[model samples]
Target: MATEALGSQAAAQDRTAGFGRLALTALRAVGRVLGRVFGVVRPVAWVLIAATITLWIAGQSLGWWELTVTAVVIGAALLLCLLFLIGRTAYDVSLDLNRTRVVVGERAVGALTLSNTGTRAILPSRVVLPVGNGRGVFDVHRLSPGEQAEELFAIPTSRRAVVKVGPVSVVRGDPLGLFERVHRRDEPVDLFVHPRTVLFDGQSLGFLRDLEGLPATDLSPDDVSFHALREYQAGDDLRHVHWKSTARTGHIMVRQYEETRRSHFVIGLSTSPADYRDDDEFELAVSVAGSLGLRALRDSQRVEVRVQERALPAATGKQFLDALSGLEHSRARAGGIVELAGSVAASLALASVVVLVCGTKVDANDLRTACSRLPFGARVLAVVVSPAGTAPSLRRIGDADVITVGALEQLPLALRKVLA
Candidate 1:
């Protein structure tokens, strides 16, 4: 009797454990399914129900069918929402933009190809892409994994802004179209929207470039493109005298060299949100730095971009501009932009011009010292982007020109003046 009782007890314990596991598994599955079901209909569900009931009161038998069909339309909408949630929205995507450039006020067209990889062809859906304005929603109704869909969007920014346009959301609806399933696409892709460049105040950059020689130069050179000619003088080199001009005028003329000087401008950007006056102000500062850096590059002088999050080395290449585009703020000020270009990496401090994007005034002293240490050729220019007008101008620390800009749209034009 004791052995039989023990066996029965063991059997009962095993049955209980099995049932518990089965119950837990059922609960988990039900939770997921129900969550999906409710998520689909929760938006405007009451309105949809009210409409269905009103139709029924009017003696429309098809109203009932509409309600039932909406509930059953789960397959299509659910599939789409699943695509976004699971991050499997597209099989492939491409960024189609010109590598060289598109001028300011010109349209920039980028194409993306989303291929369906699933066995069944996808029906109708919409994707929210990241354009310059913080969001770009694309409509894709039909396509299979192997098939491709072409979409287009306009970048409404005249200034250079890094546009990151990916991780689109795919939304689907039930058969009756009463419910929508939201899916967050997992694909990681982005577009770097460069700031639009323009000639400022009727100042021709081409003339400067040609007179100064190539767009990239560290030292100034002397070459006679065109300079005022003078009558042949004893001190003038005979080689410079033009025999043809001498014959035409019956007097010797010497070719004079044009004097072109290189600009010394430095631009520093900060990504620490804590320092910025506000979201818009910080973004404007970044845009200003980028615009100035590009212009300095074209001027045949070294341009440096130092962000609190990342620092670009001095004597840097042009590619650093693109890198600056995707800059983001950090949680801690562990790596200070001022220190990176100052005590830590002082060699990068060599510049004839300095531009600091003021977030907070924490590193104001360090930046000031760096600018002062530079030769007389270098002058530091600072811009304050504080929303509440709290950020102090750098003039307190040194002889720096400080401008408080209210918006990022003002950055490009402002930098143009500062550089001038």
Candidate 2:
């Protein structure tokens, strides 16, 4: 009897669990159906539904035939609107950017091509494009079968950013504003707007001097400046042999010349948010980095630009600017200037000078610590991009020169003082 009772209890429990699962499955199916039904339902449809419910309640309670008839009419209209807005149409859209990358303040233009691929004429519709945080809406006219239309647009490039443009969405709606449908037509494209760079005429004067007749400590046999005579090695160039010294000493002696060191600048930009007081300060720092790198490149010197862990490849002209355009502030609290210093020291051994571009939030101690990690004899410059209204100042942290600029317009002047 005890075993039979136990078995009966187990059977009841199993039946209850099975029923619960079946009920959950039914609820999910119903939810999916309702979701599909309401997904395309517009605001007008919702108002109609509410009015229908109210009218039906009144008709049942007060036995009003007029309210019942009115509710049925609204219900029929809603159904008809949904039927017209549910089907897909044959339309194709293609976006072509004149250029995917451009400098700040330059015009970025593009064209949108719309084609009607179906047999019937496509009714007038609105094309919506997602541009950055905003939307672009263009009214498109009716297109007959095998007909096409093109629209031109210019993307705003007043600031440095990576702006996303479209997955083209074509909006179709009823004339009565009862229902609407959207068809996604194209993939998104990225436009890179590079930071603005200042053009400066003065030469860089600090670390590595000009290769034209510049004296240096390191001696080489192939350079121009004569240093001392040494015993000729097997691989020494024949032209470098000092014939007078060789004849006097009765030994093969080659002329040694001091190697002229040309400046190779490596600009390190700290992207950590903690290093910047705000977005404006960060943008100023980026512009400073770009301007300095461009100046060095203009002078025909080797340049390397680094933001966070990534190093902008060795490039000049548009390619270099394109790399700078994509620089963004780091969301994570990664190590700021100190970490950047360590990375630069480890990787760029041949760098003649290091330009550290940061915001006003960094203090003198942080700057000093970062400069300490740099290779010996490398000139270090710390540029602090301060907020507007602050007075510009110049100071030194150990061997590194620190220059503070209140605004981007003041960068050229501050750079002259530091670089001089």
Candidate 3:
């Protein structure tokens, strides 16, 4: 009998524990739901709720009918806000860019599509686009069930940059502006605005006689430019054996020729804001670099463009332009022309020519220091763009040939005179 009584007591204790655990779980779930409800409530909604409670307390204490009626009106407003907050409208949003890349001054158009996929109709709302540092807002009209609306917009391309367009947000609020809700949808897209470039008609080789490929200097026995006849080597091509020369000299004579050397150019652009007197000068420097680099690539010369500590991949045609399009002014002022020149020299020691594009703020001494780090026998050209619109001048600083131009349009003319 005592054993039975003990078993009954143990079973009763176990049941009580289980009931306590279930009650705690229910409380936790209710707390979470309330937490979310409070999280989205705006300050206005909170103020109205507080006003309703205060009015109700005053009405009970003073027994005033006016206070009670005011309390009831405030409570109704709060209830409406809650109803709007709990019910979310279903929307399908998509953004499409006409082109992912464009040149400066070109129009960049984007299409936005918003479709209502819910069974009920959705009221009018505003769609906001986060563009760069600004925001673009478009009004979305009332969308019926299964209805779709499209909006076409243009992005500003006043400067060379990579503009980010997206993470669209839909804003819904009451007519009285008492409450508001925002829902973010869709990812961002990048638009590349390329710097302007110009074509130049001038020789790429400067003053390097031995390295000059234009007048082909290196002589080979079986190349394009015929030189003089020489005794045929064991491995000389039989087709190149000059029969008349061989017979006259009483020996196997082969044709001699000069082989052309290919030009490999390295372009370094200084992006530090300290290097330029103003934004215009920095933009001109970028344009000059792009123009020169593109011109070299067009002539089939191997080209490498470097900005700050980063080296753009060696490419040609559209690929090269795409790299130039994404170049931006450096935000940090730590690395400037001197450091960039040293880095470029270290990595591209065998480059045929090194071109440095900078602004007027960089003096002749800075140019000298940058040129001194380049490898021996490599020609260096320093282009300084001035914001003062000064006449272009060409002078020698240390081992580098300096060309100073005021406007971007003067780059081609300056290059022809200096590179001629």
Give per-model TM-scores: 0.44, 0.73, 0.74
Residue 136 displacement (Å), model 3: 2.2
* Model 2 residue pairs with clashes: none
Off by over 4 Å in 1: 1-189, 195-265, 313-321, 335-345, 359-378, 385-420
Per residue, candidate 3 scores C-alpha lDDT tens digits across 304-371 of: 88888688865865776677777777867558889889988889876778999999888878889999
What residue runs in model 3 are displaced by over 4 Å at the alpha carbon? 1-39, 54-69, 85-88, 117-120, 202-262, 314-326, 331-333
Across 26-70, the per-residue lDDT of candidate 2 in tens digits comes to: 999999888766766787778889999999999989999999999
**Error of model 3, residue 387, in angstroms:** 2.2
Ranking by TM-score: 3, 2, 1
Best by TM-score: 3
Ranking of predictions according to lDDT: 2, 3, 1
Candidate 2 lands at a TM-score of: 0.73
In candidate 2, stretches whose alpha carbon ends up further than 4 angstroms from where it belongs are 1-39, 43-67, 86-88, 105-107, 176-178, 204-263, 387-393
Q: Where is model 3 poorest over a 10-residue stretch in terms of lDDT? A: 206-215
Per-residue lDDT of 1-420 in model 1, one digit per residue for the tens? 999999999999999999999999999999999887778774555565565456545444555666555544543444454444333344455555543233334566666657786876777677777654577777776776578887765655454445555566676654445566677655544445444333334321212334343233222123534556778767667877788888999998887765434444556666666566465556556655655666566556655566654556535434655565555665665444454335323544335456666654446676566445543434556666654534332244567665655554555555455446
